[model samples]
Target: MTVRIVVDRDKCQGYGQCVFEADDLFGLDESDTCVAAAEVGEDRRADAERAADVCPMQAITVE
Candidate 1:
């Protein structure tokens, strides 16, 4: 199964907690807004989930 990471920009506060959990999958752009990879490999599913869990605004969705 292909893993995907989705961030709800409307709800995100750019706190960067997701970046700490999975820097390779998520990051803060020059504007300090939350940014994430659109998709990830199965091996990195856990990392994606962790990042989702840590998002303070609950703006992340893992699929």
Candidate 2:
């Protein structure tokens, strides 16, 4: 199984919170924008959820 990930660039503030929570699934580009894994193994679902929870801008979504 895999979890889908989406980061709303318009709403993202480049805070890196999501990256901190899930380094393997999230990252920041040179401009500090949120970059994310399009999909990840189900084993990483909890990490993805945590990243979503910590997103101050509420720009991260996991499904």
lDDT of predicted model 1: 0.90
RMSD of 1: 0.8
Tell me the whole-model lDDT of each prediction, alpha carbons only.
Answer: 0.90, 0.92
The collision pairs in model 1 are: none
Kindly give the stretch of ten consecutive residues in candidate 2 with the minimal lDDT sum.
17-26
Clashes per candidate (backbone, < 3 Å):
0, 0
lDDT of 1 by residue, 16-62 (tens): 99999988899888888888999888999999998889888999999
Alpha-carbon error at 25 in model 1, in Å?
Answer: 0.4
Candidate 2 has what TM-score?
A: 0.95
RMSD of each: 0.8, 0.7
Q: How well does each candidate superpose onto the true structure, as a TM-score? A: 0.93, 0.95
- The whole-model C-alpha lDDT of candidate 2 against the native structure comes to 0.92
Candidate 2 residue lDDT tens string, 4-53 = 99999999999998988878899999988998999899999999999999
Residue 44 of model 1 has an lDDT of: 92
